[model samples]
Target: MKLTAISALVVLSKVISIAAHGGVTSWTVGGTTYPGWQPYMAPAGQKTAGRPYSSYDPILNPVAASLHCNNDGNNGPIPQSITIAAGSSITAHWAQWTHMEGPVTVYMASCGAPTCDSVRSSGLQWFKINEAGLLSGTVYKGSWANGQVLNSLEWTATIPASLRPGAYLIRFELLALHQANTPQFYPECANLIVTGSGNAFPSSSFLKPIPGAWTANDPGVLIDIYSEAAKSMTSYPIPGPPVWSECRTLKPLSERC
Candidate 1:
C-alpha cells in the first residue's frame, strides 16, 4: 500500500521542520564561481560579488525589508561587482535544499549608480526574469520547479539579451511551500556589471518593489499544497508580476528554471 499525496506531504513537512534551512553558498557566472556572503564568517576584504546576509534563516514576512535580499543583505559590507554580458547564464549554488515543493524565481534591478555599492535595496525597482512553479501533476503529486533545484543543488537564470549595459542587482529566490500557511522565502542578491550594447529596458509597468511584490493573501503564497482543492488544480499562480517581455521572448516559461 502506498501513502497518498497528502500523507506524503505531511511526512515531508516533518522532515523539513528538523532539517537545516539553507541559502546560496556561491554563484557561477559565465563559468566562473564566486563565493556568497557567509554570516558566520568574518568579512574578508571584498572577495565576492554577492551581497552579505545575516544567516540562512528564511524570511517569513513578505513585507519585511529583508525580503529584498536576506537578513542584513543591504546593510553589510558591499562586495565587488562581477562582470557578465547580457544574455549570459548565472547559476546559484545552494548549500542545501531538502524542501520538495515550491517555485524558484529570479529578478533584476538596475542599480542606477556608478556601482551597486551605493544603492539601497529598498529604492530599486525589480522585474522578473525567470520563474518556474508547478510544471506538471497535482499540487502534491506534481513535479515542481523547486524539485529540480533540490536535485541539482543549483538554479540558473538567463539575462535578457537586449538589456542595456549597466550596474544591476540580480536576485535569486526560492519560495518553499512545504508549509504553505506561512511560506518560506529564501532570497539572495549579487552585484553585477552587465556588459552589452543593447538598450532595451523594462518600462515603469514592469518594475515592482520587492516588499510590495508579494502579499500574505496571494493565492500562490497562501495555498495548501496537500488539500483536495489544490490537488484538483492544473496550474499554480506564481507570485509577483509576470516576467519581463524581453526576457520572455528570449526564454519562455518552459525553458526557465
Candidate 2:
C-alpha cells in the first residue's frame, strides 16, 4: 500500500507540472476567430494566421533561435495568413495562464516579400508596437501586465494606424518573472497581411531583432522580482527597445515607460 501511494503521488506531480504551462490556442480579428497551431497534434492543414511551435514550454535561452517565436516556428509548416485593415485590433486566446508576474509585449516586422510563409523571422527587422509592464504596486506584488492577461485569458494589441500595407509577422510575448533567477519567455508569432493606404514604417533605429533585443544579463532579464530590492521598486524597465513613435500611444501602464 505504501509503495502504491508513492507511485500515485509521483504520477500526480508529473501531471501538475505538465499543466503548469500553456500557449496561445487561437486568435480573433475583426469578429472572426482563427485557430492557432497545436503543438501536440499533427497539422490540420487549416487556413490560420498562427504559426506552429514545438510545445507549450517556455523558452529559457534569451539568445536561442527559438526566441524568434517559440520553437519550430521558423521551420514548421506555415499556415495561411489572415488579412486585417491597419489600425484594427487582434486578440490572442491562451489555452491557460497561471503565472502573473511579467510583462506583455507585441511586436511586428514587415516581410518585405510577397508572402510571409517563406520569410525567415531571423532576417526580419522587428519593432515594438505595444507593451505593458508593472502597472501598479511594487515589483514583488504588483498588478502586472501578465496578471491582466491571466485574468482575462486573452490579450489584445492594435495595429498601428499609420503602418504600411504588406505581409508582416506579429509576435506576442509574455515574460514570466516568478523564477527571477531564470527568466521565462513565452513567445508566439502569427502571419498577417495588413491592408491600408498608409505608408508609415519604423526607422532603422527603431527596428530590433528578437534574440538581439534582449541579453542574458540585461537588468530586466536577470533581476530578482521577489528580492528585498524589488519590493521597494515602483517601476520596472521592460526589456526591449521603445515602441515605435508612429504607433499609437499606449495607455500608461507604468511611469517608467
lDDT of 2 at 257: 32
Q: Clash number for every model?
A: 0, 0
Report the lDDT of model 1 for residue 11: 84
Off by over 4 Å in 1: 1-19, 44-46, 247-257
Task: Go through the candidates in order and give each one's C-alpha lDDT.
Answer: 0.84, 0.84
- Evaluated with lDDT, which candidate comes out highest? 2
**Model 2 residue 219 lDDT score:** 84
Could you give candidate 1's per-residue lDDT for residues 10-46 as a string of tens digits? 8887656535677887989877898887755787564
Question: lDDT of candidate 1 vs native?
Answer: 0.84
Query: What's the distance in Å from true for residue 90, model 2?
Result: 0.7
TM-score of 1: 0.86
